[model samples]
Target: MMLETAFTPFYSLAGGALIGLAAVLLMLTTGRIMGATGILAGILQPTSLPDWSWRAVVLLGMISGPGAVLLITGQLPAVQVPVSTIMLVIGGFIVGVGVTFSSGCTSGHGVCGMARLSPRSIVATLTFMITTAITVYLIRHVIGV
Candidate 1:
């Protein structure tokens, strides 16, 4: 919790605001939804990319932000995964399935859809939140995993 007391609420809030701004700007500029799953899915398709340039640029921009910060500060965020590679892969697969079944990832429904007052998104977001809470409860409390 609190990244072991190293977390700063200021940075977290600012980071969230920046993400929201990026999502809004991307939508306004490109008329495309800014969902990571949707983007990845588009790239994975066999057909030629409709607008490969912007897709590559968006992906690169997302990557470069962290690289730029690392270069300037000579530090990366403290990240720790308390699971093995196999577990990580499994978790990722499960998340992909959920995204597919839900027709969108968290950002799609939680941020964009909710902002637009979509009823489907409202239900999807609520379902996702509740499921996440229950999973965490089981893992951390009951299962103690």
Candidate 2:
């Protein structure tokens, strides 16, 4: 069966390109790798003023990026988070633990690390994709979410 989906290819491609550009820009600007988990962890740990300063700035920029888009476009595409609050919290905890266990998050492995041609990142990204597929299948099909 042909899957005729309502996917906006333009926005998806643009967003992907932007993410790649941002990753490259971060590398060129600062020699540090642009890994969100690493950035947040670094912020949590004791470090010199300059070291954490950049992390804080990057994290804040990430947080504000959507707001900037909303201001420019005057609307954000509809996004419905279907999970309940308790499930959301639990999922967050699971993600946190996974990041810690994996030593990086999706941005780190899937985007930046893949750009850098790291084997571990390739493996991590594959694992993430597979696990996500399984989880989504279980939630939507099996459990009938």
Candidate 3:
């Protein structure tokens, strides 16, 4: 099979800008890094009521994003999962493991951490990129899946 990628530069740029804006706003307001998994985990096992409140709002905002798109564009964004359910589950499990080992996910390290010139975040982001590239190569060429 052949691989094809849709080059949606404008959409990608807009999305990246929004993500950066959110990270900045969250940091300025709460002095906390906007790591998605960390936010969810915080909600699951909160330290305080105030901590849980902000995390809940962030998660709610994430869930309501599709509704925001619908209001603006008159339709919800189309989502396509190219991989099977089992593959998705396995990928999620692997990501969970990575987050546990790394202490943060891509949003925290790649966006917030790098923005703050954090050495650990820089290394973690580099590792994430290298691992991602190798995984894609193996999947597309070796496994041909």
Which pairs of residues collide in model 2? none
Best by lDDT: 3
In model 3, pairs of residues that clash are: none
TM-score for all models, in order of appearance: 0.87, 0.91, 0.93
Clashing pairs in 1: none
Candidate 1 stretches with Cα past 4 Å from truth are 1-7
| Model 3 Cα lDDT, one tens digit per residue, 1-145 | 3546689999999999999999999989999989987897888889999989999999999999999999999999877667778888999999988897787888989999999999999999999999999988898789988
lDDT of each: 0.80, 0.86, 0.90
The best-first sequence of candidates by lDDT reads 3, 2, 1
Global local distance difference test of model 1: 0.80
Stretches of model 3 off by over 4 angstroms after superposition: 1-3
| Candidate 1 Cα RMSD after full superposition onto the native fold (Å) | 2.3
Tens-digit lDDT string for candidate 2 (1-145): 1234588999899999988888889889997677888999889994899998999999999988878889999986565677778888999999989998898888899889888899999999999999999998888788887
Total clashes for model 3 = 0
Greater-TM-score candidate between 1 and 3: 3
